[model samples]
Target: MSDQTSMISARGLRKSFVQRSRKGPGIEFEAVRGIDVDVRRGVAFGFLGPNGAGKSSTMRMICCVSPVSGGELRIFGLDPATHGPEIRSRIGVCPQEDTLDNELNVWENLYVYGRYFGLPRDVVRDRIDELLDFVQLTEKAQAKVDDLSGGMKRRLTIARSLINKPEILILDEPTTGLDPQARHVIWDRLFRLKQQGVTLVLTTHYMDEAEQLADRLVVMDKGVIVAEGSPRELIEQYSTREVAEIRFGVGENEALAPKVEDLAERVEVLPDRLLLYTDDGERALQDVLGRGLRPETTLVRRATLEDVFLRLTGRSLAD
Candidate 1:
């Protein structure tokens, strides 16, 4: 896409960390190798990867918290190296770790944070009320941070991030430790933000979260981008329509791989189960049964972004 239409753009972007060796000279650890990324305005974009996959490094550079080691990087069509303050003023960030002051009440936390951005007291107060209501934390506005539940704290953090009315919102693992219900709540709020024309850039390891929030995403592995596309597009390009999960007895799955390899288009042998990738998982399961192999359990499900990740990286997303 053209630069004029892209809110964030990168070409051959790279980040490295200098690590000192115990017995030798320092070594450079490449956290983000050469990669290109483009985030259009008013769209939710994601960086998906497992631990130590350069997702966080890329995000740091984007946020201007970490300097780029090499290559081109731009936010709002301006160079981060020179326009860090200008860019930061227009973006809001919800970090992975909760940084709220435990001694302060929820509303106070938001009010204080807004003050840091040089907002007027009346404006900050008004915005705090609106944000607390938006995140469904209106009832907890006067509650101390220590009294809030995990989900409530997360909601407060999201609300605080919006105090500035930023054009772009950057979330790092927004729902990392929340329960399913809590995660869905956060997702709904984020969906609303996107509908209101806020550009969202997030980093996540959860395949479902990426699929649910991102219109387009890039899958990163070992400091490099392995694939980039929408959830459905990546799944269609890298995996089959369906996946057949067959679980045998412990230690029995490995031996059965060869016998059932020809039944599906592709076979993935895990420690406890075998995944058969094919157009029709029910048909594949029938073929396996016809071959006289009785599995302990069988499940047929549609392909997911997790399946595409496995196909491209030959490793599970959780790994």
Candidate 2:
């Protein structure tokens, strides 16, 4: 069994799929380019990127569902290629999309899944009760899977993955479609799991979710990891401690962009305004106006992870 120390490790892990088009041409699709990752035990690690960023493919390789085409991969110190079943048996997985058995009631869903792992009926029953409470689904214990809301379905998926009491839990965009209340509830449960020393690995397109939950993470684009570190470390290294925003009063944002270019370590010009990243945002603000550049408004504030991603990738993460 893996202990509480780097349960997941990889070196140059890679996967590619070949696709043939209807136009009569075949091409190779590299879903996950060569990448390295290490997820330590008892902490939440996230893969942050927009859609089609290979986050899902990289996750599959770590979970051992998709065999890697190149390089090394180990979950719990066992090679995924050869120890697939053993590794899987010791890990919990909540996939990107819900795959519950619609025919099963909430309780039966848990019971049936537990039986798949060969758990004794009595053990399954006891664990089912506990899990229902963990996810706050006890009140709807007998509801059919088809009858649950989007949030309830997600919570049930999380509960089902834990039935085996796996050493590691992997969640791929687990709360994508939930309401804000439901999302908060899920976040609270995840925080409790982390506090209890459960190792978690998750992928998400939501920057706020990544910032709120991840202890350490990797930011990916295209098919490779562009940056990796704790959330705060990344912001400090790639961006300034603070930023000054200046909106154009009449002229274009670029008209004032050159004025603040060297006032900060970096300056990014957008359609409506310009951003100056520096240690002292006030100083940068004074410098911009002192240069005779006129603007509608100026706002100074602390740096955020969103700024770091934008500077590194040359575009907003969502767009």
Q: Pick the candidate with the highest lDDT.
A: 1
Please write out the lDDT profile of model 1 over residues 109-188, one tens digit for every residue: 99999999999999999999899999998988899999998988989999998998998899999999999999999999
Clashes per candidate, residues 3 or more apart or on different chains? 0, 0
Question: Candidate 1: worst 10 consecutive residues by lDDT?
Answer: 1-10
Candidate 2 local lDDT, 1-319, one digit each (tens)? 1245778888987889879888977899998888899988887999998888899998898788898988888898999889998998889999999989999899998999899888999999999999999999999999999999999999999999999998788999988988889999989998888888888899998878888889999998887999999999999899989999989865588876776788998888877778888999999889878988767899998987778788888877777
- C-alpha lDDT values of all predictions: 0.93, 0.88
TM-score, per-candidate, Cα-based: 0.97, 0.90
The alpha-carbon lDDT assigned to residue 209 of candidate 2 equals: 83
lDDT for residue 163 in candidate 1, whole number 0-100: 90
Residue 187, candidate 2: Cα error in Å is: 1.3
Clashing pairs in 2: none
